[model samples]
Target chain A: MNTITHYSDEIINAFVDGELAAAERRELLAAAAESDRLRQRICEAVQLKELVRGAYPARSPEGLVKGRSGRRGARMRHAAAAAVAVLAVSVALLLPRPEPGQRLADGALSPVLPLSTGEEAGETTRVVFHVSSADPAAARELLDQVELVLREYAAGNRPLKVEVIANNEGLRLLQQGRSPVAERIRRLDQRYQNLLFAACGNTLERLRRETGEQIRILPQAVIVQSGVSFVARRQQEGWAYIKV
Target chain B: MKTMRPYTPFLLLLSLLLAAPLAFAGSDDGPKHKIVIQVSSDDARTQKIALNNAVNLQKALGQDNVAIEIVAYGPGLSLLTSKSRQGKRVESLAMQDITFSACGNTMKKVARKTGKEPQLLEGVRVVQAGVLRIMELQEQGYAYVRP
Candidate 1:
C-alpha cells in the first residue's frame, strides 16, 4: 500500500516562491488535492511564513529604504555580532525542528529572521455554526463555544456567516413561541448577518408525534438534519471541523 | 391474442434509436464532481498557487460551476497583503478575483500583540469565524482543497 506522502520543504518552498514551472506546480497541486496531510502542512507553512514576516517586516534594503545599503550593512554587521548569541538562543528555542518532509514557506535555506509584528492588520472571514442537541442547555453551550470562536475570528467588522441547524431534540431551541433559546439565538442572528438556523424535517415529524405542535422550535432555528450527520457531511465537503 | 403483435418489434427498434441519442446527450454534461482547497495559510507562495488554481478552475468551469474560496487564519492572513514582500507575487494575486480570508481570532491576537491592525488587501474578505466559514461553505456544497 502506498503511504500518504507529504511535500518536501524544497518542493513546498519552490511552489510558495512561485519558482516552480507550471507543470511541476500542477503536479504538486494534484498531490495536495489528493492528501489532507499535505494541505495541513501547507497551511501551517504558510501561516508560519506570514507570522515570520509579520513578526519581522523586512528592513528596506539599505539603498531602497535610505539609499545606503553598505552603510546600513556595516551597522547590521556590528549589530549581528552583538546579537548573534542572543539570536541563536532564541532561534533554537522558537523554531521547530524541520522534519524531513516538512515544507518551509521560504525553503530550507531561507534565513531565519524575526518578523516585525506591525504588519498585521485584521482580515475578514465568514463562518457558520451547526447546533443540534435535545438539551437546551447543551445546545446553548454549543452556541457559546461557537460564539467564542467567532469572537476571536470576527476581529471587528464581524464579516462571517454563522448557521445553526437544529433537528430532533435540537429543534427545541428554534421554535417560534415556547423555544427557550429563541431570543438569544435571534440576537446573535441579528448581530451576525451571515447567521442562519436550519431545522430538520425528519426530526420535526417525530416531534409532532410527541408534542403535536412541532416542539416549539424557536424562530431562529432553521430545520435541516440531525447535527452529527450535518457536521459529517460538511467536513467531508471540506469544511473545518470543531467538536465544540 | 391473435390481434396484432407486429408493431412490437417496430416499436422496440424506434425506441432504441431515440434512446441511443439521449444516453449520449445526457452523459456529456460531465461528471458530478466537487473539490475543496485549504487556504488556512497566508504564505505568499501558497496564496499564489491557491489563487491561480481558483482562476484555473474558474476558467475550466466558467466561474459559476466551480466554487472557489480561500480560508485564512493565523499567520495565513499575511498572504492577503496588497503589498510586495521580498518577492512580488502576492500583489499580483490580489489583482485576481481570488478571495483572501483571514481568521478573526488570529487577527485579534496579532492586533493585541503588535498594537497594529493587519492590512486586509483589496480582494480580501474577512470571515470573523474560520471554522464556521468552512462549515458554511461546506454546507453550501463546496469542495475543500488545501493548497
Candidate 2:
C-alpha cells in the first residue's frame, strides 16, 4: 500500500538522516518509487543530510546511535548510526585502493587518505574553495574573501566550514616560506576551526621531481592525495564548491 | 548562438535502457538533483572549464536528472555576454535546460565602465545579484560547484 501521503518532509528528512525504522524505510522507499515528488523530496533531504554531516566530517554517528532500543529518539539515533556505518563501509569498499606510486598527495599519511575530523556540532555552512591560479594577487584576494566569509558567518552566529583545496600554481599559497600570505594563513589558522587548508600531494611530488627543490607546505595545511580529487569529493559530499 | 534541434526521446530511452541499472531514469523524468555553479573569473580558460564542468555533470547525471544553473558574477559575467568566445556553447547548453545566469549588478558595472550594458547571449537570465543568487540557491538545497 502507498503510504506516501503519510510521510511529511520532517519524516523524509529523518529518513535521509537514517533516523527511520526498517519498516518505515521500506514504506518510504515504496512510496518514493511511485511518486516523483517523493523521490525529489528524498534527494533534497539527502543533500541536507550531507551538509549536516559536513559539520562532523569523518566522525562516526555513534553519538546519535546509542538509544534506539527504547525511546523513539534513541531508535532514530541508532538507525542514523547504522545508516552512516553502512555508508562508510560501502564507501570504503567501493573506492579503489590506489598503489603507493599512485599516491599524489601525502607520502606521510596512510595509503588511503584519512579525512581529518571536524569538531563543530551544529548546522554548518559548507564551502570548498578550489585554488589553482598562482597569482599572488589572486592568492591575496582569496584569503581576503576567506576571511570575509568566516567573519560574515561569525557575525551572523552561523557555523561555517571552509575547505581551501590547492594544487598546481595555487599550491604556493600553502608552501612554507614561499607563501605570499604565510602570516595571514598562520593567523587565520589560529583564529578558526572553520578553515581547512588541503594541499595537493600530486603537485608537491611533481614540483619536487621537476625542480628538485624541497617543497614544504605550511604547518597549517594538510596534504590530500590530489587537490582536484579532494574538491571533487567535497562537491559530491554536498559542500558548496567555489573556485578562487 | 544556436537553436535547439528536436530530440528523439525514444532513441534516448532505448540507449539508456541498454545502460540500465538506472544510473538515471530512461526517460525525461525531471531533475532529482539541483546544482548551482559559480564562475567569477574572466579568464577564458577558467570560463571554458566552467561550461565543460556543467556539460560533464549533465552527461554523468543524465540530462534530465540534474538541474543546473551556472551563475556568473564580477569578471565571470563575461562568459554570458555576446563577446564571449564560448557564446555558442552557452546558447547550446541553454537549450539543454541548463540555466545561464548573469549578475545584474555586474551588468551595471560594465555599463558604467563602457557606457553601455554588456549584451547577453540568448536565453541567459539576469539575476539582481549573482552572489546573493548563489546563496539563495544553496539555501534552496542546490549543490554548488565551481570548476
Candidate 3:
C-alpha cells in the first residue's frame, strides 16, 4: 500500500528541483494522477523547492488543483478518474525485481536537511492527523483526540499547527451536508488557522460523481490533494503523524 | 478492522520530538519509485484492488521507472494460486516484471491442511514469509500500500 500511496520525500523534492529525468518525471506525474496522496506530495515538493529558490507565489501547476469548485469538478471528474484507472490497468511490460533495500529515488540518497525551525515563525508543533475511515465512531474519536491535543498544546503555551486531512470514507467528517459532526468542526475551525480541516480533492470528486451532489464542504475546511500525501508531507517536515 | 488502540492517548503515547524533521531519501539513479502492495484478503474485490493498484502503478510510473511487487499471505494466498480467478492477470503481470510473492509459511499451512503443496501461477516467486517480504521492502524504502 505504501507504493500506491507513499512516495519518499526525496523523489518529490528532486522532481520539484528539476533534478529528475523526463522519464522519471512523467512517471511521477502519472502516478500522482490516480493517487490523492502522491499529488499532495508533489504539491509539497513544489512548495518546498520554490521556497528554497525564493520563487514562492508562482502559480501552481494545472490538473494538480482540480475540483476547486463544485460545478467545475463534476462529471468530468469521473471520466478523468476512469481514464486514469483504465490507463493504470492497460500499461504492462517486463523488468527485473529491484533488490530489496535498494531505493529508487535519487542516486545520491543524501538526506536533505530541513531548514532550522528555531527561526521558524513560532513555538509551534505541527501535527497532521490522517482520517480515512467513514465510521462515525472513528470520526468522533479523531475529534476527541484532536481536542485533547489542542488542550495539551494550549497548556504548554506552544502554538500547534494541526491539519486534519479527511479522505476516502473519512471525508464525511468535513462534508457540509454529510458530516455528522459539523457543529464541532465549525467550533474548532473558528478557533483559529492553527487547526486546519482539509478535504481531499480526489475524495470530493468521487463523492460528487457517486452522489451527483455538489457536496459542499464546511466553510473552514481547506481542499487538499489527498490525506495520505498530506500526512506524508507533514511527516517529512518532521510533523507528528496520527492515524485516526 | 477492529480497534488496535481504541482509547490510547495517541499524543501521550507518542510525545514526538519536534527537534529535527526527517532527512530526505532521494537517490539520483535507477528507478525513481519502488512500491510494495499487500494483498492479505480472500475477498475478490480486495484482491482486484490490489492488482489494479500494482498495474496502475506500472502504467503511471512506466515499467522501467518503478519496481512493483505484490505479496500475498493467509487468505490472500489464493491470489497466487494457479486456479485463482486472477491467474491470467497475475501471469501476465509477472511477465511484465511485476513480482508476485506467495508466502511460504502459508503454503506450508495449506499443504498441511490439504496434504499437497498448492501450485502457484507461472512467474510467481515464493518468499520465506509474506509479511517479512513487506517489512523488508518497507525497510528498503519501498512504499508499502495495503489495499
The top-ranked prediction according to lDDT is 2
RMSD of 3: 23.1
Q: Candidate 3: TM-score?
A: 0.36
Q: How does candidate 2 score on lDDT?
A: 0.70
Error of 1 at A160 (Å): 17
RMSD of each candidate relative to the true structure: 29.3, 19.0, 23.1
Candidate 3 per-residue lDDT, tens place, A34-109, comes to 5554575467556544443342122222222221221121124478765654443333112233321232132332
Candidate that would win on DockQ = 2
**Candidate 1 lDDT by residue in tens digits, B35-144:** 44555444677766776777678688764454456676655566654442412444444455444566676677678998987776555667765555665565555666
The sequence of per-residue lDDT tens digits that candidate 1 reaches over residues A107-207 is: 54222211111111122232334445666656655666467755655665444434466655666666667576677777776565345565655676677
TM-score, B chain, candidate 3? 0.80
True contacts kept of 2: 0.15
Clashing pairs in 2: A67-A74, A68-A74, A68-A75, A104-A201, A104-A202, A105-A201
Show the lowest summed lDDT stretch of 10 residues, model 3 chain A: A65-74
Docking model 1 quality class: incorrect
Error of 1 at A237 (Å): 8.9
